[model samples]
Target chain A: MSEEKRTDLESLGEFGTIDLLTKNFLITRESTAFGIGDDAAVLERNEEQYTLVSTDMLVEGVHFNLMYVPFKHLGYKSVAVNVSDIAAMNGTPEQITVSIAVSNRFPLEALEELYDGIRLACQHYKVDLVGGDTTSSRSGLVISVTAIGVVDKSKVVYRSGAGTNDLLVVSGDLGAAYVGLQVLEREKSVFQANPDIQPDLDGKDYIIQRQLKPEARMDVIAYLKELEVVPTSMIDVSDGLASEILHLCKSSKKGAMVYNAKLPIDSLTSTTALDFNLDPVTCVLNGGEDYELLFTVSQNDFDKIKGNPHMTIIGYMTDASDGIYLVDKNESLIPLSAQGWDHFQQ
Target chain B: MSEEKRTDLESLGEFGTIDLLTKNFLITRESTAFGIGDDAAVLERNEEQYTLVSTDMLVEGVHFNLMYVPFKHLGYKSVAVNVSDIAAMNGTPEQITVSIAVSNRFPLEALEELYDGIRLACQHYKVDLVGGDTTSSRSGLVISVTAIGVVDKSKVVYRSGAGTNDLLVVSGDLGAAYVGLQVLEREKSVFQANPDIQPDLDGKDYIIQRQLKPEARMDVIAYLKELEVVPTSMIDVSDGLASEILHLCKSSKKGAMVYNAKLPIDSLTSTTALDFNLDPVTCVLNGGEDYELLFTVSQNDFDKIKGNPHMTIIGYMTDASDGIYLVDKNESLIPLSAQGWDHFQQ
Candidate 1:
């Protein structure tokens, strides 16, 4: 018999793996307006509206560490992240189905605490917890959430819609969540060495909350709607700024030039990065899990959001020939690469 | 500080755990027609139709044993089970989002095999492969599928809609899948004891296929629709006949009396059960994973499906005060209990 070919999963990476697995699937449903290769799947709902569906999975040890993370926060973050996908499409989330697989080692109260956070997110987002499956696992906890949202057909944004010269904007700040995760990991190490030693999490509430209980940018979506500024293209910043920029550029068949000086990094995040011997700019570029919206708007609509404090105009889209680059503070153009978190590599 | 009390998850079981966790959640979305406590959640799609969404999670070790299960069959089974939920609601599945988490120990080829099965199932069910998340896990492979379906508002069925004196009907033969699992388990034990010994699966093809690749009874739904028979209440036979009957009774506020002699058990399944020193009737009552449609029809519509070959009239619904029981072959009445598979207790 001929030897079967074997390839490591690390070689394909996450995106490559997904593409390889799903490339052969043909979309045959008329209701499916868009299938795969986007923030969420778009389904035709009505003449004026579209339904959006997105799914996310978080595996224990790979996605979160329970040593420093509370169950409630984990639950809240799981829902928030899936909601962020809907927000990326500029849609209003209506319902979510959360499926969790947990080992018997976890007590009933632990799951209850998790659901308490889920309930809070449902209340905050005004989304219904429609249905889900709860099953037992042999190892760690696994949470998979699917969010369904709706948007006007004319207003829905996709990553492949960016036009050349369109302004690239991002909501809120960046790098806080990643920096906060570092602090938690450090504390975990200290507590592991000496169980009696208390974690010194004083004055790090902002960063810690950014990591544990990050909110989806539904507020930004609402603000955009109020301003009547529909983005040409959009994606959520779950896998670092550089990675998201690359995704938008690749999907839109365009290039981008983002200014390092224009990147939004909270002062606390900057100082925390420096304290950990890391550069704030690097963290803002490559650190992930911010759950902020990164999008592009036409130059004509720039005047509406020009001085908006909630959003930052980081750069503009360029011709595809011009490779994606970051204009550093020193006036040097640095090629951007996605050093986003790859759980497989870890 | 006083020690916090911990409750074992085994005490709640699967259904109890979900109920306890979701009891406090209030539905706030205007689009939510019905939330939880059904085969699928119902959402308002349009004036004429209702959208249905259901999710299921399969964890390795708990849901399937890789030693005996082919990755392709596992993938196919996962999608089929989720589609079964849609069928249970008397809906047509249109789209599905499949999220998977796998350890690096699995090769890229393994995932391809898995997705091939997913693709095949998508083609079979005519469900579009939409969006999903792919991530890494610390241990075994996990597959989570969310199926999106649509049904006419007037034809939609729910577990809580059955009326007293409604005819209880079931599609396909019961306990075959469970018996197939036993045969596979026996072969696995034999293989483990002596590596050189080949599996004695010569004449067990039908039963083995039932266990590995059970199909959702969408055909039955189509037939019912063609016959103008709308079920009053419906549920997929996933957790055995007794458990499903109990769910229907609890949801509909009714009771049932199932006849053991009337259960549609195939000859092969019966012979296999006898070989394993098991009662075929007992397996039919408590053995799960049949993926058959168990539904109730009004007495007026019984004539339409009276001589149908695909369906069997197992029993009928009764008043809530009548209690649920099983009439054995000896004509003795016995109260039925849910001995369906419990992963937590295992």
Candidate 2:
């Protein structure tokens, strides 16, 4: 290899490589309203309706560990993660196409277990498995899913549409999935040391389930519809609250101040985080794989959701000059930093 | 993770996993006309147009050898292969979505080089970049791209639509890409053995180019449009001609008789195959990644394409009882086997 041509990926990081890969991409079709910058791409077919499409690829060894992970939950979470993208756009997922590449190392029964979870998730989410491609892989299993959905042109929400005064609300609690992973890893290590030991997973069940079989939050979409709520901007917190909130802030051209007191931490997640020697608040900010929707609501609809059992008003949008900040219980304003899924850190 | 729940991916192979994963997958919406069983999945929207969507994932080490393959060609080929799937359905090139997961091993500039080729392909095919996800991988780079294109409801063809008495035709030539790959691999081996020897690629440019940068036959879509001809069935020859023909047969409930002499072979591919002591016909039959279009036309339209220079009428579709046969140069009938890119065999 040429000395100058020896390129390393770490130097680019995640966003840097992404920017490099897509810089020259041109939107040629008139139907493509938006492309790479948003959570989900927007395509318009007519004046009345628009189509939303997004895709995600999960590589074995990179995304999961088969040793401790169930194929069934893997299947469910696979669909849920992609579906969460659609839910973030305030769109109902109509169809999904799954493509899988596997080596001969998997068994028919094992695959049956995987698909059973897929079928179960399909039944749960009301998504159709319309089409997919099946091919052999040289290494571990890879699942790539593309979801297609539609919404009225006027109702489709994007990450860039948030206004300055919009309230930032997150459905469900944060840090649960992160805490769940801590428990799973702790048990796994203990079990590894002593094969005869049984896992002591009592109160951490919710967090464990959050990490294992999280739902797409389509219920939130339906609930929002019934409540006549349309988020000014929306995003799913797959990569933690801080990173997601930053996305909303960057795209919406606004800043936010989320109160630490207002942050929802499930009892189980908080206790588990404490057990792991981690700060629960920091876990909420930096923890990922929550699959919860974080969205902005106008002040006009505040009263309608203020009493809701499923929603929590974590903060409100602020002027760009104020910057993204978090007011802790000490009444100190601290700048929010996104430490979500830094896959490129040395 | 339980001791009782040990499952390996290789036990299922590729097809078994697919069947297991999509066994219960259903099409709930009217727009999804076909699902899971064909080359490209089909979707219908609005009145006169149907959208064809297909996705492919390429993982480093598994899909390509970065040692020999340039990153730029990898990006270009990624888009080309996905676009070929839309063309497989006799659809026009339109919009595509790309998702990539990279490790920390790459630099920002490297991604730019990759995207530069992607943008070139987009400009070449006139397909818009829609939306996709960019994330981190623990290992090699993984790229998953989904291309969506529109086809007139009447003109859109499926592999299952062919019938007895239809004529089978292919655009451009076969096996050139595969031969080109052979040449590149041979050169790489030599280069690895000793870097002092430069690549002996002189007079071997055409097949090498074909393998490195194969173009999807969008021109055939235009040609059929101009000729006012609609193919009864169509598919891209990505998995070699034999496998594609088998797919057409299995889907369309028919058999075929492909004349060996009529198979198109570029002069360069034939000579290169000879140099490698390989049968040119076999390379053309079982070689893959050509990205050429193969379709079955109605008997009535045969005369319309009788004098067309771009397309060659290689064979005719027949009853399933007739069996899939290859008429050798000696005029003897021989059963055709699909030795196309067997990941298991690889």
Candidate 3:
């Protein structure tokens, strides 16, 4: 490192860093149908089925602050996020491996509480807790969860499958998790200033729940199966709408045209964003950790999804020659920029 | 945690912690051929094969030290150790997901060096690097690797398959990795006190390599296939020979009797143990991180493995009432104790 050119991780960004490090890791196994560039890696289990695999790691202080985050909530969020990754692939998760590295400072009871949340998530998802590794860390806590799922080979979707003219749809409202985080941060600062002052998060239950216990949209996946509609391409909104949409565009070699006013935002999210003196539109575009499913379907299937409470068509795919852009409220076109959560920033 | 029963993690130990936490995780999936209590979790992929899954977490300070250990070796060892788990199950690893949580203090160049080793190991094993998550940490680096493998249902081995009178066999020699660690630790201290002084590790290359980069016993697995010998029960020798033998005994509900005379000990390992004023027998019994395969084979398959350069028959399984014991050089019986690596100690 001393003699080589040193590059700061923050400047490279999280996805950029992953791309740089794994560029040479060519997939040689025939079973590996897809690797690296999607919500989940797909492997052909047999001629008829494909196994979907995805892993996510949550680090204390970087992902969540224990001072405001309960261990139970943290555990549930960790599993839910990984489950969302599987859901992004339009697959049903059947098993997961949860590995945790905790500091000695954490008592056994603390871990039990965390496991309680994990157990609840596993039960809710109906996925077996198959295997895991537990070891002590020198500092803080680290939880890494890998989810395994299956999908029919004919029904499998990929990020590179979207075509021009496909209608873009989202499963849930955006920006609530980011706004909930703002509320928590503000309340923490207020408590620090005056320990006796109680938190005033009385009627903000929706946003709080959205942030603390976000659910993977397995219900939407089930609904899609019931409707007999398969998305050409899909991704989860873990890194906000803007970033995820751009990823889909990059992988599919297409462009997207998103109508800013058509974005689904919770009323509370908009109100909270205004209260924090931030633009609500910006929050909806860039707010992360929503865990919502974003997908593109053929125009022929648009009527089937029309008027569905769970579905919202916000945009349409465009030819690669057209740049990814957003039509703002003022009817002005602006190019989209990805401002996803970058954990490497100091 | 304060008012309730605050049990310490050390009292629970690593294995105990995993058992207690996952005890309520009911495996409702029909695909789960086996869950927990083995080198890897097994899933029935089809009538012909079972999918083997295992995960391991490596944390800096607890599992390794960057002061002396190179990141490249650490990367290779991490993947190699996880692959050993699959090998212990008599499976061929096909894919792996590696998640690393690193602090922002790390340079992009350092991560590149680590990935270089990871890429090398993947190439050597011919396994696809499917997918993983990378995130920033507040402290030292944490790596979690999950390996997926496949074994024919007829050839699959588990830690619970051994029966009374089965012979215990181990691949390769023991105590070398522990002695090598001692050498590196001594060199580190010497370098700390006098940075200008060169390290005196010229002839200790064999043992040092064993400590820094232990290979998984996949070769032994291939050899066993060639000999058409399926072990009754098997496990990887990561937590010392004594501990691994006890694990197989417990899982199989049998007792084992190992003779000190039959244990394979390298000449360099014995010479280094004496240099450190440690008992060579004790080191062979209690030193961990060998990454060798320990298995129990039926008496009928003895001829297939006998005289094999990679394997040594060290012991035999016995009735549960016989109790696990070690036969000393003096011909005295002593109870076996498992002093495996427990990372929860303060």
Candidate 4:
């Protein structure tokens, strides 16, 4: 037999594989304003409006485990994460289509509960549930959602628009979701070891909620619009602060410096990290699924966002040669590395 | 323990479940022109055009078996099916987002080959590959594609617009894909029983291609536009001719009469059906995944479609009281029953 070259997928990773595959795309439609390199694709739907489109997939064992996660929350999260992509574009999500593949092990009532969560999320986000396909599966359940949103042509923001010296801002705190995951893992282990043990989740409500029912920060986007501030570049913090910041930097051809002292970490998140014997700062930087907005604004708009309670200016963009780094509380500079989740990695 | 109420999904079936779940959707957006009832959802993008969106999911082992299906063909089929939905709406497909969940057992080259087919489909359809998510799965593979299309507000056709006496027309022949699937399944069994036996597949190219790489009828759509004939109602024939006609009838509150002699069946499909001891007429009526266009044109436009080599006028719409029926060569009327695919049914 002739030896054919076979490369493992783990070596290329998710981001690398996507970049490789999409580099050959030829845009053929005049309405396609932007394609394949952002949180969402932008299409020129009219003279005044640009539409944003994005999709996300959640697999049973890869993205969630039903043993600890309720089906309703899984349904809500599938919608929320896709809505987050629209929020990252500074656009208001208007419609979504959800497709699912389920095994027969799930009953009709289980799906009803899941759709209840989806209905609640649609109501909360004010997005219409437009169309989708449902089919049976051989393995576990899979859910894929595609969201569409619209923004005025002038208000659309992209990750590539950030310029050097722009101020970096973030909405809400980070790391709580990761801490909550750790807590859930611990409880699962305890239950597996002894069925009599009840989960000790009394004081961990904040972190646990962060993990299970994360919200897309549409309120922050509305607040920014109310304050008359349009960010130069924006992205949702789904893959941790460090990875998202790097994404903005790579696309904008700039670097960033995040001060350690300014990184927002909730008290519950910090306490949970300590309990897990993990560094709280590491958790804040690399913990994922926060669903916050990480954005860069022109230095001129600093005053508008400076004192906003929902937002904090964490850092500033720098020349590309300077590289991405974290300035510690002791005024020491350390280079940042992406420790975000990569599902392709073993 | 007190007994809790539960319903089986199989009892409701796929269509019944979707209707039950989506019945309560409150469409708050003025831009939402159509939701959840047609081939694709329609949204008013501007004053001049309506945007169409649709999604479909294919699960491994459930939708296609890898033993007989090539990865590239699978990817091509996945994109083609979604594109067909836009064509069903009489819209020009503009862009698509393809989300995939794959197990790591697949090498990087497998995905590269799959993307090659996806890229080719995009080129052939003149649609842009916009954006999507890629992640790992515990299951074999799951592909979900969302296609976006556009049509002039005045020209968009819906499933609910058919009237009594409209002429029923279909593009190309039926039952070829199902015959192709049977060929592949037979070849698979032969190969499984003997290691050294080379299965014969010569002269079966048409049927095999129909199964592995079905094309969406965008050409027919374009041709109809050139003829200045807009179908009163349209739906792509994915779930067999009988089922699609039933969907149109149910949606339009009408009935239809199909003639057995007028039903277009390819020679290879008929011969293969005979070889498999299956009725050729049943194959044409109940076999799915043809990806042909089934539409209704006004009686006044009957002269426009009479002699088109690419189309066949097989039937006509009738009042709801007449019921859907098939007329045999002997002029005997038989009630048409939908025996099309139901993935949820065992």
Candidate 5:
């Protein structure tokens, strides 16, 4: 008798698994300008424009908990995350197709609430909800969204386009969304212990909102354009900051140096991390789901964006030989590591 | 407290549920040529072409039983179904994005096998796999696919274009895939009852293949183009012939008369359906998942496709006042009802 071999999915991680599976898929269409290995796939649209396609799936329990997360927020977050992917490519989102599968446990009203949130997001982003699929699942709810966007041929950015000495910039403060999730989880635990007790989420509105209704940084994209400073490379911070930096460095075959003092962390997030007995800097570096734009611009273009309040310069790219590192508070060059969320590992 | 209102999803059904949820979403993008209520959404691409986007979600147990379905076939069918939507719009599929959520129960080898089938389908359809999302689920496997296609501006077809005197047509045979599923289900029950049973799937290859690996009718689109015949209205037969016929009637504001004797049922399907003591006509009318093309053409163009081996002319369009009906073998008119598979109702 012959024995069969089996490999665990946890060992490969998400990116590794996708690489192993899609590595052999040959690109046979002239319309496919780019395939995989990016925030969104690029396709040739016309002489002056390129189309961007991005998709994401959010499974209940795996991505969110219905106990504390409302149906409307889930729907809105799903669209926001996918739109962020388009923004990561330096494109303007124009349309979205959302497909959802839910069990009978959710009534028609529940789904209606979900659609309301989706409609709100569409209106806020000015993207049309063009199409979708609705069907039944055996258990839990799964929402998948695909966003279509467009960019000028000359303005589109990619992770592989970062240049040596480019300044790394990020929009909005970091670690708030991660801290928001922690508060939600804690409140959930307290409620599970006693159903009669109300969740005490006072004075944490900013962080909570960051987690519940994080907006895609379309405004930052507009600001960069107004400043006449196009990013050489860009990515969305769905994963932790450290993990995204590693991705940029690997894709462009460059190294990076970030200063711990320059890391952006909200005061509420810092205080909350301390209350939870965790380091705020670690949360900013490793906590995810921020949806903020992490990008790099040429050193020469720094003058245009240096005083911009919406964005901050966190680091600079270096030669590959320098290796990726963070200058800690004590002036020590600590090698950066990625501890981003991996659902399979969890 | 006021009594909370709750509506069951089963009562609304799939189409009704989609309409209710999306009725309030207004299209805001100039690029959005058409949105929702069709096999695929259309967007303005350029001077010569219009882009098409179609999406579908398949869930385990509700959509397919893993006990009987191979992983590779499921992967292939997922892509095929989305491509079928593009074909229904008379478009050429150019790229596809496939997102899958699976639990830890599935090993890396299982996913690799699934991707192997996806790659094969991409090759066969001549479409590029541009991008997708991969995530972990709490239970079961869910696959969502989005296909992008393009059609010449002059050749684009829509469901609302049928004329009162148009001829109704269908590609390939019907009822085979439904009967094939029945055979597999029976075999599965027998296997569950007794492990040592050498199942009898003999002489059932045609029907079984139809159910397991149904191909999108892209060939029909090619043939129509070659014959210089453009369908006035079209839809993919994913939800049974009767249901699709009703969709054409409702969308085009016309009535249809289908002749039962003209339904293209393969000999194998007829015999197998009879063996199960089921009416073959009923299966043809209500059993879904055929992945065939159902279309209407102007009577003036009938000569172009009158004797095509791959297509069958089953009926003709009538005035909306005449109502939709089917002429049975007895030459008696009977109102057509949609008993097509509805997962929510099931």
Candidate 6:
């Protein structure tokens, strides 16, 4: 074979390929007031409102293992994860295009179970299941979903909007999803070794469910509106809490001082981390796929939302010179790094 | 596996899965004015326009063979084919999200050449290259692209809007893409058996190019406006001429007649089909991925377009009782069937 005949996808890497593909794009339609360059692609729907569009692709074996991943939970979590992206933009999801590429190895019943969870998510989140393509795959299943949502123009948030002193807050708990993954992996190994052994998952249900069926915090978005609190910046918890925090910080050209003690982690998540011989604090810092909403609000609105039960202020934004750091329980500062999963590495 | 677990995707079919998945989807958000059943998903954007969202998945082996298909042509065709879908709704594409899962057999330089073609398309189409996911695939390469486009409130066309007596027109010529496929396959066989034999493709460039790098008929869409003609209904020629005609017929609740003599076939396409000993008519009717626009215009504008190049008025709409029929050169009546490539069958 000629040496010139072979090419690798990784030389482009994640960032380079995106830059190459999008460099020629010019926004033409008036309706497309904005395209790309953000957490979600923004569109003008009305004089007062904007539509946000985001898409994600999840492939089996690469993204999930069917050995421990139920088809129903997989479906529900896929929808929820995409919905969380829209939520990070402070947009209410309206419609979703859920396209799945399946191999013939999957049974009709398996697909039905997957769709059942999809339908359940549509009902819970109030997003319509719009149009999608179903095709055969030569390998494991591939699910790609494009979610569309509308938001009042002024209320839309971007990760780049964080400012000095803006209180960084995340809704619900963290690290549970990552801990749950460890639990599932352990159980899968045990089951493989001895098929007769049932999964010893009694106290780990909360963390496991969080990983399997995480919910998008659309309710928190609505609540912020009722309290009349507009976030200065926002992002969703997907690639672990630390990586998401770093994204917001880097995009905003600022730094963050996250309080490790204030991290909202479920008791079960903490327990399971210890039971699995993992550090609970590390789980809270880098455990991923929580699908929770992370945002920053002005200190003035703090009085109003501080009374609310769902909000947890985990950190504060800092000037770029301050650098992003975690305030450990010992009061020592540690610079953050993104240990998030990179599919390219797989 | 048990018999119950052996039900394949083909057994469920396209409509079956769609019916099952969308059964319980209740429209929750007001912004989701419409969902599921439409040809293109309707997303309300500006006060005067709507954004059309659609997605398609192309997998290696299932969609194309790397041996016969060049990466550059594959990239261009991918974007063009997607843009054609937006054009089908009388909308201009504004943005796209390209998600690809590739195996390691491909190198970084090969991906660069592929993106080089994608960038060229983005320049030609004037659409932004937006956010997308890149991951490793276990087998072959999988590309899922979601295209977004916009239309004027009054100008946007749908599959359901064709009226009785509407004239059916198809842009450019047909059968060439399929004939081109045959030529490429034959050449592939030649090369496989005798490594030293040069491919005899001197006069078959047009057919091969048509097969490899088919252009989406955005020109027809632009010309229609200049001619003061608005198609009452339209669809792109992705799933063959016959399947598209059937879509218009089914959506309009009307039958149709297509005169085979009126079917346009380029000279090179005809020559290539003869070389392959394939029926020209069969190629035109059943060939997929033409990416040409097939639309229905009002009868009042037929005379204005009669002399124009790049289009052929192949058929006319009639009452449902009339049924869909095609007249052959020998004056034989043949019932039309959507023998377009069924992905399920593959």
User: In order, what are the TM-scores of chain A for the candidates?
Assistant: 0.98, 0.96, 0.98, 0.98, 0.99, 0.94
Candidate 6 per-residue lDDT, tens place, A145-208, comes to: 8888888898889888888998999898888998999999999999999999999988778888
In the order shown, the candidates' Cα RMSDs to the true structure are: 1.2, 2.2, 1.0, 1.4, 1.2, 2.3
* lDDT: worst 10-residue window of model 1 chain A: A1-10
Q: Per-residue lDDT tens digits of candidate 4, residues A180-206?
A: 999998999999999899999999999
- Candidate numbers sorted by lDDT from highest down: 5, 1, 4, 3, 2, 6
User: What TM-score do all the candidates reach, one by one?
Assistant: 0.99, 0.95, 0.99, 0.99, 0.99, 0.95
Off by over 4 Å in 5: A1-3, B1-3
Ranked by DockQ, top first: 3, 1, 5, 4, 6, 2
Where does candidate 6 chain A have its weakest 10-residue lDDT segment? A1-10
TM-score of chain A of 4: 0.98
Count of backbone clashes, every candidate in sequence: 0, 21, 0, 0, 0, 8
lDDT of each: 0.94, 0.83, 0.91, 0.92, 0.94, 0.82
Q: Candidate 2 local accuracy as lDDT?
A: 0.83
Please, what are the lDDT tens digits per residue for candidate 3 over residues A119-213? 89998998989999999988999999999999899998888899999999999899999899899999999999999999989888899899999
What docking class should model 2 receive? medium
Off by over 4 Å in 4: A1-3, B1-3
Q: Model 3, range B1-346, lDDT digits (tens) per residue?
A: 3456788898889989999998988999988889877889998786698888999999999889998788899989989999999999999999999999998888998899888889999988888898898899999999999999999999999999999999999999998999899999999999999999888998899889999999998999999999989999999999889999999999999999999999999999999999999898888788989899999999999889889999999989999899999998898999999886777753
* Candidate 6 positional error at B25, Å: 3.3
**After superposing candidate 3, which stretches have Cα over 4 Å from the reference?**
none
Worst 10 residues of 5 chain A by lDDT: A1-10
Between which residue pairs do clashes occur in model 5?
none
Q: For candidate 1, write residues A1-346 as lDDT tens digits.
A: 1138889999989988988899999988889999999899999997899999999999999999988888999989999999999999999999999999998889889999999899999989889999999999989999999999999999999999999999999999999999999999999999999999999989899999999999999999989999999999999999899999999999999999999999999999999999999999889888999999999999999899999999999999999999999998798999999998878788
> On a 0 to 100 scale, what is the lDDT of residue A295 in model 2?
97
Instruction: Pick out the ten consecutive residues of candidate 3 chain B with the lowest summed lDDT.
Output: B337-346
lDDT of 2 by residue, A1-346 (tens): 2336755666655665566666766676887887887767888665687778888877676677776789999988888998899899898777787777766666555666777787888778787887776666656777888988877788889998888888999999999998888888888999999989999987667889999889888999999999999999999998889999999999999999999999999988887788789999989999889999999999999999997989999999999888999998899999998988655552
In model 4, what is the error at residue A223, expressed in angstroms?
0.4
Model 3 DockQ (Cα-based): 0.82
Task: Give the per-residue lDDT of model 1 (tens digit) for B268-334.
Answer: 9999999999999888888989999999999999899898999999999999999998988899999
